[model samples]
Target chain A: MKSVEPIFNDGFAGQPPAKRALGYIEDQKKNGKHVVGIYCGYAPVELMIALDLTPAVLCAFSNATIETAEATLPANLCPLIKSSYGFIEKDACPFYWAAEAVIAETTCDGKKKMFELIASRKPLHVMDLPQLCDEPEALDNWTTMIKKLKGFLEKTFEVQADDEAIEQAIRENNQKNRLVMEMLDHSALENPVLGWAEMLDIVFYATPGRGKLINDTLEKGVKVLQARVQNGYVHGRKGAPRILITGCPTAGDAAKVFKIIEEAGGVIVALDSCTGMKPFSEMIAENTGDPLRAIAQRYLKIPCACMTPNTRRLFELDRMIAKYRPDAVIDIVLQACHGYHVESFKVGKHIGERHHLPFLKIVTDYSPGDIGQLTTRIEGLIESIER
Target chain B: MSRSAGIDIGSRTIKLIVIDNGEVVVRKKRPSTYNPMGLCDYLLEGVSYDTIVATGYGRHLFKNYRKGEVITELKAFAVGAAHIAPSCGTVLDIGGQDTKAITIDPKGGVERFEMNDKCAAGTGRFLEIMAAALGFRYEEFAQEARLASRAEPINNMCTVFAESEVISLVTQGVPRSEIALGIHKSIVSRAINILKRVSTGRTLMFAGGVALNSCVAGLLREELGVEVIIPDDPQLVGALGCALHGQRS
Candidate 1:
């Protein structure tokens, strides 16, 4: 399949940050720099940066390695877990081999168990993530876990992360978050300055890469999009149905749903997945005397489906719908992902009853076989909105 | 006055209906073989209409070939059912490869709809497979099931597994009629679960080729305890709706 070029104004374009990050990792590895592969948004990559170690996102987004992973894993498990394990076992992903170690969190049962199998292959650390963020002891519990991770990283890399170093890392990471949020805000315009593919490219590529290079790349992207908005260079049709996409983490091959929605003439305005707005929507408070506590507070508020009594996610969805004012909402759930699939009822009800917007939940996998069915459903949704 | 035409290129069959001055002037149906486009061409040959609308599984392929408007079967069924039975509160369509249940607003608009995902458990194709497994033709399958003394209670819904279950029961000395009745009951239960999700009123319009099965139709009425309206030619509803849309546009 032909890859989509990211939309830009005034001929501003470059290689996707995801690819550039891989090159950076290889270059840094040659310099004898310590690198840590991280999975899930809950892993504190900020701590890795504070220790002067490179943090690379190790989540798998393609279906190529899933067949290899499925030989040991069950075919009914979530595709994301399978793909991630597949890449590690098959040694297909360069970033996985480049990392000196991997950091995983207890975000979901599937990942927690999969991390056990991974420990035998590589040096790995697993953080026991608290699922109930609303409990009074949740913050303290999570802060301890964050401190433990910091201790592990310091010992593993043979580097001492002083308060000054962590403070500097927190400040720089907060700036990166702000730049990303600014780039995403461009889509909120009546005539969006970014297309769906462009937005996905910007978020997925920028979020995983580390240091001044990725930050500068993101800043340049925001500047280009801002310039486009100023010149009234919109990416999509002016009056197309604006859609807000919410559900599981969508990137790589799973991005087919987003492409289908855009092809059906719907402009995506907000993405509520981990690959999009979820991780960067909030920032770590730089002014805090204890940056670890601040980071703990922010990451716990991610509102992932694995959390019990996940009212915060619904509140965030309400806030996004009000801000973006999308004509409809589409929830993309990967097949066998019970958390997102079961939570879709609450999401649909909230959107329908409170916001009074049309809601569609598309349960799919990482295969191309269901492209035809997806197109029909998305087109039907657009038609309903038109009427 | 010039006429408007609608063609539904379904998985099993292709249906065409032409409307002139707000009246149905032509109606045709043909088996949709491997090449649905060729069969669609055959169905449209010599049928004159000023406007054309295509729907069903092959609607997109038809649009690429004919360059005309297309609508999803979900909307098509709601419009057609409302027009056929003005008081229709919902529509349940069990087509060749998929099934749909749609709730309609009083203004003939689709309020909400649901379609079976990537699975063909309670569709017309499911019934045909089970009928063949029992060594009965499609037309006689419903009659045989209706004449059974009691349903033997088939437990499987997956088409392949259900066929295996039927074979196992046949070898166990269970009567063919009882097994046929069991198959009908299983399919009806599946359709009922889909219908219950979308139906809010007592009146429902049943469409698709599966509606022609007397045992299925009788079971739906018996099970739901509501008014079930089956149009004269149930499979032609989508084509009729497309024709109506062509007339308006």
Candidate 2:
């Protein structure tokens, strides 16, 4: 389990390993190995790994300077798309130069056009996945899509993926999934070995094909953490409320919500967010006879804030609440996120009315300094819960 | 005498309103440009003001005011709607670029609000795009829509696709007004979807630039099955909200 260097280097030549890696990908292509790049979050990373092709996930560029995205996209487009457009205009993304084919799912209307626009720019193949809100239909559509994708890969790579290769890939991916899930479980232990923030850093770094190394490090850290907790070194004082946080990135102001809860004696028992649990959830179902259906089923169940019409979020919340037995539920909705903000309130009200549970709502942006007010609010919420 | 000013720098237009002792002394709207400070200065050329509050997409970019408070358009709309129609419980503002439905408490506080910030399906920008496609000015487009006897809504959600659908309707010898009405109805339907997501109940007050378009408003009211209230000058609602913020502070 060795950690690979970060994907992007200052310049192509500055990092010899990364440059050599890119060259290796090019050589692989010359040797008839297909190269595919998948967009971040909800991508079938394991399936792609099983395919034996180099799979790089697309993350929005860190530095963006362009302001006017209205010319290309509608003014009302989501910030993520706007920012990604800005990144493209600025030529900041390294993926623009490397990958032979790119794929994006139709998660939102903004992302739909993002795929179309990127495809229009160059002769890139785009996979239009149906919105997963339609339950069985969505699962069926996704399975059909994966089979079509596998066919495309076979044709593009000019390699025959026999049953053995597919099965072996699925086995390797399942093992990887088990390790990642185990790491997540160990990381969640009360007063566990690793610091949450440090673990998140590892998660971000590991996303670019370093999962095994991260799992190993986390496995060791978890052992130490478990011993400390058993020795009562991680105990909190008398009356802290147990809680669960659901959000993205878990950095900046959003992460501050968790800090406030912890300070108020609330231990975050479990989380159901892409930045938390969704990244390494249950593996692509191993036992299903049809691998594509298994992959689709596994993805449809992944926790996403953007779940629409047939979203199982309410069910997920109920399950998390029962498992964690938290005093209250706090839903952090980021500004300009129409999907999450709308869903958060509905879920909050449902949880309050049906389950007789208390719900707290926190609206936030990217600033971490706003935690002072947030802390006060959480403390008040904790007081109310205690009463 | 304490004089306050509220400037709303929207994506398409910049609006300024000077309020002195709860009276709106001046109200003006101008095209929003690269420099919002310049636009504000032009609008407030001879006007003297005390506290200034700005809200909208470009609110944070303007730095010419003495004391400025930047608030989201949602909060600003709530404050503005409550000031004019005290009985209004829900505020539905469709701006040039975005649409929002805000449910207000009886005491004029925002209980909950939902906004359409991801697409142009129900926005004034969508109308403008439709109008441009039909070879008519935005003002004429709504009037022509009024003349429509019946509307057959084009159901595609994507703006690019919807625009093409409108062109096909034109090609098939459908009357312009009917197509325009259909476009308006489509916009209303999209808006209603969002309103349904976060609505408390019927009592909705419609504001923002799109509220002035009678055809869109009419379709929206018909679709929601609720009487929609439009302010005297709906475009200035965000600026008016900023002015009201000044009054409260």
Candidate 3:
């Protein structure tokens, strides 16, 4: 068994786990195996599994500087690009420097520009998938993108991704994704099988190429959690208002907000975050024989708040609300996150008018120390919900 | 007396204010669209000024308008805040698309400024998103936010994740007022952080569309432990600054 090494920004909340993933990946590379770097929420882990390559999801560098990023990208571009440019500028990650190939998608304007800029700097094959809200055309576009990505992967990895190999990868990935979904479903049960923090860690681990291993760990963890739930070992005694959280990457202060809610007796039933559900919920199409098409389909359909000029996002929210039946909604939009803020208000109003549910909007930065005020707010919210 | 006009072409709206003898006699706001020239002409109908100064996101795009003197939004904001509140030293301007913390000298000269131009977390746009999510018009967001009794700190930096978190809270039946307060507090914290990054002085003034939200301003006061000075018309600070720039230039 090859070890995986997870290398990421130290500022990321779950640095220990990210390091573990990086260690595993490093071990695999030591065995002369090729490592693939997947940027953002687009890489199909299942396809990576099928290709027998180690998948390393690249996150933005925390210490990125404007001076470093300005060498390759325009100053007016999104910070995500500047961060990526900073990574190349600093030569921080070996995976970025030594990867066999890099993969990305046109998920949003920032990501689209990121793909273009990164490709210009390095040799990368990008998949321009249609906007997920477009439905029929989105599926067709996604399928084509997947086929092209598969060809690129085959050429880059020099692996014979024959029909058998592709099918096998799809099946494994489907099972892995199903297990993950099942785990999330289990955690959201009347008596949750997993703790909120543990569930978040599970999502993070499942993201990189270590989905298979993480699924195995979670399977065991779920068994233990199920027994505990059956035995009534849950911490909170009072019935809490079930809730869902939506926001961008919960890197810094954002994660603290979740802790505040759970402490205030609000059970997080679902999450719609750039770093959490959006990356994991992307499932490969079942019928698509081409792996790249499967990847593109997953990327387009994954619900993201960053999709500008995308109205169909409301329908996605409606579905999640129905599934979770949350008593209320909270929007944790950061100060400068324009896309999510726009969607947050729109969705908050939609849920209020249509579902007749209460809506809460909270804005935050990347720090956990601000949880004191947050706790009071969540406690008050729970009390109001009870009333 | 010489006549001059200052126009702010923002991502969401266009603001035009005409100044004569250091007084703003005419002010107009129009939705920003594809044609910058057309919008400028429509707003400036029947008005002729000697000099025009352009600022904001789309300021550089208007080439035909008066060979205008262009100034960054930061400088324009300081000029505007100084005119409205001469005693204010720290200016916090939360616009439609971005948020900035500008520290000014006693004379209203910009000492230093920190801006969040990359993301949409603490801007007017974030409030608009929350308003839309709650089924309220963009105009009513500040009022709704004012109704908040307590603010639950939302922990996500990305707007997308934060919206989901907000939806989850609504589904759980959190009170509208508390949620509103929480949103305001979050934005205040972000603005405060930006202020800390640049320079922390005294007499912080809140400007831009977000300045219209007293709850947000109140939260800023609470977080920064300073009194926030909100002018009579917070939205016009940028244009007022531009008009003032016309007089000074």
- Across residues A1-387, which tens digit of lDDT does each residue of candidate 2 receive? 013222222243223222333454555567665567666566665556556676654434221322544568765544456656665666665555556667676665667767777776644455555655466687877777777777776666665665455666666666555654554454345453333443343344334342344345445544544565565543344335666666444542246577667766676656666555556656665655676677777777765666665357777777766655666777766555677777777877777787776666667644454553464346545644553
lDDT score for candidate 2 against the true structure: 0.66
Model 1 lDDT tens row, A1-387: 123224332122454435655766777788777889888889876887888888778888888988999999999888899999999899888889888888989888899899999998778989999988989799999999999888888788888887778889888888888888888998888888786667766666656556787788777777777778777776777889999999998877888888888888898999899888888888888868888998899899998999988999899998898788899999989888888999999999899999999899999878887777777778878878887
Q: What is the DockQ of each candidate?
A: 0.57, 0.03, 0.02
Clashing pairs in 1: none
Off by over 4 Å in 1: A1-21, A27-32
Whole-model Cα lDDT of every candidate shown, in order: 0.85, 0.66, 0.68
lDDT (Cα, tens digit) per residue for candidate 3, span B66-114: 4887666777788889888888998888888778777776656666555
Candidate 2 local Cα displacement, residue A124, angstroms: 21
Model 3: how far residue B84 lies from native, Å: 33
DockQ-wise, the better of 2 and 3 is: 2
RMSD of 3: 21.0
Best by lDDT: 1
Off by over 4 Å in 3: A1-15, A61-88, A94-98, A132-135, A210-215, A235-237, A263-265, A282-298, A306-312, A334-337, A363-383, B1-249
Q: Write the per-residue lDDT of candidate 3 for residues A1-387, one digit (tens) a residue.
A: 012111121233344345555666777788776778777665566666767777776655343354587677665554545555677677776557656678876655666766665676555878775654456777786667667777787787787576667667777676666666666665456655444555565565666544456557656655655666666654343367877777666542246677777756787777766555656554566756565556565666655665545665667668778776778777777644567767776877687788877566666654343443354345545644654
| Model 2 lDDT per residue over B44-83, tens place | 8998888888887766566335458766677678789888
For candidate 3, give the lDDT. Answer: 0.68
